[model samples]
Target: MEKMPAKQYEMGSSTSTKSMQPQKFLHSKRIGHMDSFSRHEMMYDPPSMESKSMPRSSYFNSSKPWPDLESDESDMENEIDIDNLPPIEVGPHEHRLQYTYWLWFSRKGTHRATDYSKSLRVVGRCASVQQWWSLYSHLKRPTALHPYRDLSLFKQGIKPMWEDPANSKGGQWVIRLRKNQIDRAWENVCMAMLGEQFLVGDEICGVVLTTRSPECSLSVWNRTATDHASTTRIRDTLRRILNIPVSVPMEYKIHCDSLKYVAISKGPLKS
Candidate 1:
């Protein structure tokens, strides 16, 4: 096939920065079982004790920094051949995640939205490890996205919007990085989510990734920011998963705050 049409996003325009040193975390239960991602059949089972061991290396290692997404003169230099690359997940399994997730994309920023609902588009949905990897492999990394463009993966029926009932009471943990260095952090965060390492049970709603000049941020949304116990666990788990350094701050914002401020960044940036 001729070289693929020019990709819509461009990465590596600026120097990269390393994330924080991740604290050592004890391994949690391996992802045990789940139902399919079909909208109607979505059901998550209770965590099982029959947890499998996933080598630290299989996912991101808290000990090391992740690779940066950079390219000079060509997209091929940054592209990974999906067909030839090793599978992030191997084969069909007997289990699935508790909920099917849908990936949403939008170049429209909060500034462009006459209607928040109309600005975003659903890219696809996934319920299995293989399925998640397949979807991710086809998409551009967060770093490749233009400033203000965002990618959000939320539970099947839950739109990324704060207005969604499932997310209305919740808040998100934000990880900020330089524009071209978001892929590694983005990958590790998604893997940890898809792997069910948060141990917050079904409290997790989904995650959103957005890029801006000088900063690319990924945020994990959970059901109740008021539930301090669950939210704290989610926050700390995210820190280790993303290997966020202590020097870099992580912000928490209630969905209600978004509605109040009418600016997505305001919620997170508010005190």
Candidate 2:
């Protein structure tokens, strides 16, 4: 895979100096059912579609840290050959994760404004630490993606969409951060989830990182929206894992609520 040039940023002196230590959360425990070796296929040939580039608006100026839509396409093209890559090797001594996870990618579609799910594709799947790192190291960081692009890490059988059976009754904890702060935050939270640091078994369906101008957001999706105890535990774990201050707000929106909002926003379907 071709490595795209990393975009440099001019950080202002006013940016937060708080350094995050993500290494401390590396502790892992075998928490769920194990998977067979044959289940470790890590790539697929995603259906191709014409790239629809959105015009750069005034909101996306030169000062923004992320690349524009044009540059994002190059990153996408680099990833298109993932399916042709050789399978990742997993040694007998390698540490296996609790559950198999898949890395999915999607960009907002111009024609189907509300149905971005149509663009969702599985880019990688991993059953162990080595497999995960091999795939992750090849992808661009959140800062390199375009505003509407999203990267999701979900359990093997679960889809990242709200409508998925595993996700239909759940919600996500959303946290928005400045562009400079997202890379580490995203890496930490993902590690926390994969390590089962949250301690809520099977509740975590997936985690998503969405890139936008000015700020990027990370959300943790769980299986039960009504389980206050589990939800609260997930939130507290997120704060600790990300080293976020209590003053920073974290919002939890249930999938039902999100579905309703989308339905309302789209209005009634015409005959």
- Candidate 2 per-residue lDDT, tens place, 188-242, comes to 6786777777888999999999888877778999999999899989998876766
Q: Write the per-residue lDDT of candidate 1 for residues 49-152, one digit (tens) a residue.
A: 23223222233222222222222212232222223423233245534656667777666544345477755655545666545554555566566677877789
Supply the TM-score for candidate 2: 0.68
- CA lDDT, candidate 2, residue 145: 78
Give the Å error, residue 43, model 1.
24
TM-score of each: 0.62, 0.68
Local accuracy by lDDT, each model: 0.58, 0.65
Model 2 CA lDDT for position 40:
34
Give the distance in Å from residue 113's predicted Cα in candidate 2 to where it truly belongs: 3.4
TM-score (C-alpha, index-matched) for candidate 1: 0.62
The regions of model 2 sitting more than 4 angstroms off are 1-90, 269-271
Clashes of each: 4, 0
